[model samples]
Target chain A: MQLTGGQMVCESLIREGVEVIFGIPGGAILPLYQTLPEYPKLRHILTRHEQGASHAADGYARATGRPGVAFATSGPGATNLVTGITTAFMDSVPMVIVTGQVGRSAIGSDAFQETDITGITLPITKHNYLVMTAEEIPAVINEAFHIASTGRPGPVLVDIPKDVFEEMGEFEYPEKMDLPGYKPTVHGHPNQIRKAAKLIEESERPVILAGHGVIISKAYDELMELAEKAQIPVVTTFLGIGSFPDDHFLSVGMPGMHGAAYASLAIDQADLLIALGMRFDDRITGDTSKFAVNSKKIHIDIDPSEIGKNIPVDVPIVGDLKLVLKVLNERVKPTTRVDWVQHVEDLKRDHPLMHERDTDELLPQHIIQQLSELTDGRAIIVTGVGQHQMWAAQHYTFKEQCSLISSGGAGTMGFEVPAAMGAQVGRPDKVVWSIAGDGGFQMTMSELATLAENKIPVKFAIMNNGFLGMVRQWQQIFYEKSYVATGYSRNPDFVKLADAFGIYGARVTEKSQVKSAILKAMEHDGPALIDFVVEQEENVYPMIPSATSVASMIEEPKPEEIRQ
Target chain B: MTTTESPKHTITALVEDKPGVLNRVSSMFRRRGYNIASLAVGHSEIANLSRMTFVVEGDESTVEQVTKNLHKLVDVIKVSDVSIQNCVSRELALVRVRANVQTRSEIMQIVDIFRANIVDVAPDSLMIEVTGDEDKVDSLQNLLRSFGVLEVMRTGTIAMDRGLGDEQTDKDNSSSTHRMESGL
Candidate 1:
């Protein structure tokens, strides 16, 4: 039963019920790979790049609600995971990153391939540890899992020295972690809860600003009940896309700098603001002093420090959103504020979320809508950040939180396809869609091989605008429409590219053929890419530019008043 | 005035041995818009295992809920209202006071009055070490400060039951008994 540290790590991972580990090998982690083959149940996925592996792990974490494990060796291998780790950290995704450290004696001396990964990742991870012995490896892994998945869940790292993995020790996993100084309080003061409930009951124009915490805490049903009881309008953060169904009467879409005008206006006029599972990031709350000035705010989040960090909270509730929302729903009286609801509806009708409709051309919004309708809100929709992603957010009516996953924090361009493949593996029964622009798709197009190899049948809808659409839009607005390096001349034929991977592919240039093309892609059963040649000059409008007050967004330009 | 009784209260805490646990604990109450008149924590029967004692100055119902929530954390092992239980509390402080020729004899007399020990004697300073409850430490520190106290270091207050029974002892004895019975 005695095993080396390398063997012990694989054994511990096996014990944790980890079926697959995504990693890239190098000199520092040779010992780990040497022992990995012995564990038949644990599969090791050899990623082409450490970034892909980290993102794949992140995808798995987002899909499964469990910490996805990824490993890499020191130096370049570890550095490659930095962008992915930061992506996971910024979005509060739970992950366990095990990096192969240089030998203990060589550390700090800057020996070959040695890097201070723990020091480098200090600010990004929830907590990290350097294992000195094989015996400590199991405990550190256990602690990493505990910290990564617990309150305000975030990524944790364990840097394992090469020598420690080669050493021998008793391999016993600790049942409980003894982190004395790291207790997080997860319940609200009853008096404060009561006070918050009373304020909700009293306010006429109340709104619920739901964020990613709602999804993380699985509080959608409770949030719905609270909204119904208070009859308050609900707007969401980009990450909280599907928290409340877009079809719901009270569901105004996301409210922020790039959010729907009606949602932003509602937030601007609210008398009582109940912010749940939201950090009130700068994107959401512009000029914090001016945001929600007329409202008495009740801020509820899992982390205590975030309660008043950005905006002051009249009543701060610290606990899991599900529990807090359930309790709040129970205490709050059922009352309908019809007048306030109608006022929001008025805004919605006055300046609707508009997309330029081109009858003969395949548009991004049209493609996204057909995709949403085809999936019937059951698919996992991931997006590469750009006009395509925003179009999906604006048009697709997602039914649940986490249903629409994207890199909201880092907004990494190449994350959609591989992340979608990772998500599909987690949700095998459901369809997974990766909606990326022509510019974003090319960033991680190599992941097409991953899909083909793994037999993960993801639907990739590439809005082929033949340019970096968002950047192009900015250039059009800010700079004279000179079109610098934004446009692409000889774009690769996406159908031929998908065919190169030995999968189904199609190109839809006409609007009439868009639905049939998507349906055909969905029917293929293997990985399929539908490159819809959308209008190159199309821009995502109703966009409240950064730092611009949400109240005064330039709604769609009049039909004839268009400058072009 | 509403003729209703308020809830009970208990101060439950988990503390580290870093500097200023007392000031941090007490000041937390002040900062969070609460008031704490009494507080305590010290090394348990187990080394580096510290026990905290603090009274929750609040309504009874609110105090009960707070204690329950606090005990839910892994760091917080036990929660008991020392106010209800007969307990002993103690604090240790080292006071370094100026000991010039004129003040040395007077300071020595004052130290003796408080049953303090001169742990260190520099050319012009005597370090007087004292241990007791909060009031005793405060009174002693006041007396020494008048003698031109140079510096002060106090171990935060720690408390335990006056009787033989304690959480640390109970767990230790149970484990030992189990080991003997199992013969492992």
Candidate 2:
């Protein structure tokens, strides 16, 4: 049973059901890479950068609901994964990160390629370890995977020195993780569940604020049943985009800063709020003083810490959403609310979220809307942060649970390219598209080379605006239109960039060419990109000004009509 | 969510006796912007487990968040906010004071009244060791300050519940026995 630390890693990961590892090999990690060829079952996708590797792992985890794995060398390579690691931490994505360090004797000696990755990722990861000896490798790796994939899942890092990887170890995998401090509560208290059920049955106007926890717990069916049984409208948070079907009858759409007007309005008027697996982020409840003013909240989450962290709750049930909802569904009375539904409908009709359709210039919303329909509203849509992210969330109708994989908590600018590639790799059966803004596209367009090399078939839809559209809109609204460094007027040709990667590329500057270009990219096979030249100054509507009440959401701009 | 500040609360935790457990606990306090009034860490009653006591200053919600976040760490075994419980807390301080011939008797009188022991004696200085609550230590330091207190070393407060609750908790919660059975 003697094995090298590198073999123990491979064997442990195999036992954990890891089929692929997204990573890059370097000086410190060479020992592990040398052993990688011996194990062909672990498909290693070589990314251009460690950042891309970590983000791809995040995307894979989000797409599959399994812990995604990433590997990197120490020093700069490990530091580069910081943003991606923080992104997963913020969004609660399950990821296991393995980093190679310098030889044990050379550690902390300013040795080449030696960095304290476990220390650097301490605040972000659920748990992390620095394997001191070859013997601890198997157990540490097992614990890393277990911690990453359990409870309120987040990334976990395990740092291994080069000497340890080369040293021999007894490699029996630990079947169970025995960390006393790591137990997660899964079942709800009966009293709390009963209180929630009573609240649900009594309230005339109820809105279910479904957050990312629902998706992580895969409580889609239970959520639907609860909403149906109680006839409550469901409003998803940005990260909770596809937790419930976008086209479901009870779906009122997303609610937040740039969320749907009707969705926010519904929350403003609701008598009771059932917040499931979603934290009351500031973005969701802008100006917490006035948010859901009259609603009594029932917060259910596996993490006890998240309840009352932001928004105060009336009935807080600490447990897994699926189990809590199962009991809650059993206790609640089934009834329909006609007046509440009609009121929400009226709000939806009064404050519809729409983009300018009469314009001849290619609108990003139009392109996303068209793409959503063309792909049958089933493609896994990933987006970079900015105007394009909001546009995609608003325009595209997500029909499947966890179908939209985008940076929510971290809001990383260059998330689209690599995350889409990872999603496509994880779910080969589903079509994956990267809808990125022009400014964010250039930040990580190098990932396109990884896409082409791996033949990852992720379609790219770059919303080619001349500026960082979101920032530009903010400046226009708040800073007297001084664009500053927000303009990327001399951006590179995205089609040409895609072509350089040996991927099919197309350009669409008019509305007429949009559908055809998307179709052409879809037909090209391996990987494809389409550059849609969108309006330069388009704004995401129904935006509640930063930290303000949803009551201050700007439906349409008025000249000198600024509120006090 | 409450930004209002309040008096300090004594929080205690039983954590794994790992090399970086203290760093993990302290780092989270700094990251979450929770101010630490004082901290004490030592070997606990159980083998391979360390108990940490932190006096943190924040409002109800913020302190609740601090405890919750601390519990989130995989190395932390159990946490208790002893401020809300019937707990006995103590701090140990060794105060070195300028004890000249004229002030020596006066300093001895003060130390005797405070029930403190003069652990070390020098020609012009006396080191008094006092073990009590923080307030008692603070009072002793104040009395010795006029004698030109040369230096002082203080161990931050440690606390324990004054009942059977803690003993029962330790019996039920100690996972020190739950070790990873490494065949190596």
Candidate 3:
């Protein structure tokens, strides 16, 4: 069919099953916006900034397990997507980012609003393309989606010039992609699975370390079967919070810096470590040399590079976790780990994760737990990076798959607001809570207007501590109480700001008002914000200092001894 | 396996002949902190495929990482580690050395002994071309150093395994010939 490049792009997106896109219009990409009216199936959310657009797309992908689509103009618009692209890259989210370039004639000429975005994003994207002709639009878009969504998914950029978007072309979408170098391992070697089964049956103490791959592969059932059959406890990584049920009998919880102490202790004591789809990131493994010292690890993952990248393993099986576990569950025999489970349960009982607030002051943990409790631990929670994020991870109980979404590897500060909008848009039937500290919430608070315009039903809760809480905690511990520039003495009234943006708003200062405020926000038909005035100096405890061993974890002080 | 001795590896890769693939290759190497001793690229027998040969210094795991990382690039089709394998390889060097009045005859005689050819001759210098493995080229350069070598250019190592109907082979003799030639 004869079509313009813009029509081809819109057609290709629909062909790829993309129903929504989050981005802003710019001069270079006007052709796409002009063509948008003809295709009513494609819903475009006009984000305030390009960064928010990319992150919202990221949140959409995380929630739905489908590749998210985003659009932007050239130059600054393209550059703004860098942080979001890197965030997706670090977390391995699948997204296809389309950026408009200056006319082909002015590509290297440094024309107005021109940027070599593909060159800038070389190392960050899984693959990128600079389309010169309109004839290749359908094929390029098809290839971009295929590459972005398959085999350890990541963002792929397709930079189209304004001329290409306006040029005439014959659209033909390819049904299959032929990429020899991109073939990923999908199934494990049977011999290796047998070996893993042997180890599982022989080991007295076994611990399962689950990561985001389990969630991405949707292997929760297979994982539960294997863990239950072998009687091994599961410890999830930071981003792997919702991959396993937090309330399960064998779940030991998250381990590492700011993670539960018993989980880290369990890792240190295990004789066999069955690692699934996690890279053993530095934050998770405090000191690589001493991490799980007594455990002989068997690492199973789809990405072969991740197997031995950080920590060496005894059995490295490269395959999809769900398929690998399905085969593994057949050969594995049921075992009884009565004493080891009891010992770990005792450790969990001794070092139970809880909130400590001496006075009647409102704590962020109290708010997070309330949100979790009120929703029956089923609401999808999105968070930005900071003390509030850690509180959400430690305090909230995740019972459903993909229940917690946060900027984990990147630790991006301004992620909550737009990401929550994306998550809500992706799964409109489910309830989503946007939780952020005052420091992080202000970074992209402009997206509140986007939320109001779209009527995206996300309940936003601002943990107003009046400080960059995480940085302040570090300063208090290592900098001898020198606060430096971390403290914010004055702030805007968030409730009033939410009201200005045409959303329901409330403020909570007393402890008694916390539950009611959350309930009110949940009961609101549309987007709502609750400004929570929390203790300013509370630190996330059970901390493992950077590069320190699990033995050196600093426990939290007693509630009365901390502060009034 | 000695701690003091650094290990070196030879890798050859097949990549699509397109723009920026080389940059992607080098960028990955640079970002990963892999040290390259020599690299050479040219069109292969295939129509649109280019072959690249790189000689790099790394340990056992580092070499494994280099091969695996190169494979991750979408443009790269095939990669082989021929560092210690039974492969026939060659290096070419053109040395421009001081050769005035009487020393020119001695230089020509030494070149004859090494079977090297004089590619060019200026009034004050002789440009001698030598082709062999890395050790052979280094030996000729060392012999000419006493005559005050003016300049030299060496095409890094390019290799092919013996008895090659296939581009890759699974045979191994486990010889340590690389240890003898992989030195600086």
Which one is best on TM-score? 3
TM-score of 2: 0.95
lDDT of 2: 0.89
Residue-level lDDT of model 2, residues B45-141, one tens digit each, is 9999999999898788888999999999999999998766546678899999999899999999999988899999999999999987777899899
Ranking by lDDT: 3, 2, 1
What DockQ does each prediction reach against the true complex? 0.07, 0.72, 0.70
Q: Given the true complex, what DockQ would model 3 score?
A: 0.70
For model 2, the stretches where C-alpha displacement exceeds 4 angstroms are A557-564, B1-6, B166-184
Which window of 10 residues has the lowest lDDT sum in candidate 1 chain B?
Answer: B1-10
Looking at candidate 3 chain A, the ten consecutive residues that score lowest on lDDT are A352-361
Instruction: Give Cα distance to truth, residue B101, candidate 1, Å.
Output: 26
| Residue A45, model 3, lDDT | 96
Per-candidate fnat, comma-separated = 0.11, 0.96, 0.64
Give RMSD to native, each candidate: 9.9, 5.8, 2.5
lDDT by residue (B125-179, candidate 3, tens digit) is 9999998777688888999999999999998988776544444433442333444
Best candidate (score: lDDT):
3
Between the candidate structures 1 and 3, which one is better when assessed by TM-score? 3
TM-score of model 3 vs. true structure: 0.96
How close is every model to the real structure, measured as TM-score?
0.77, 0.95, 0.96
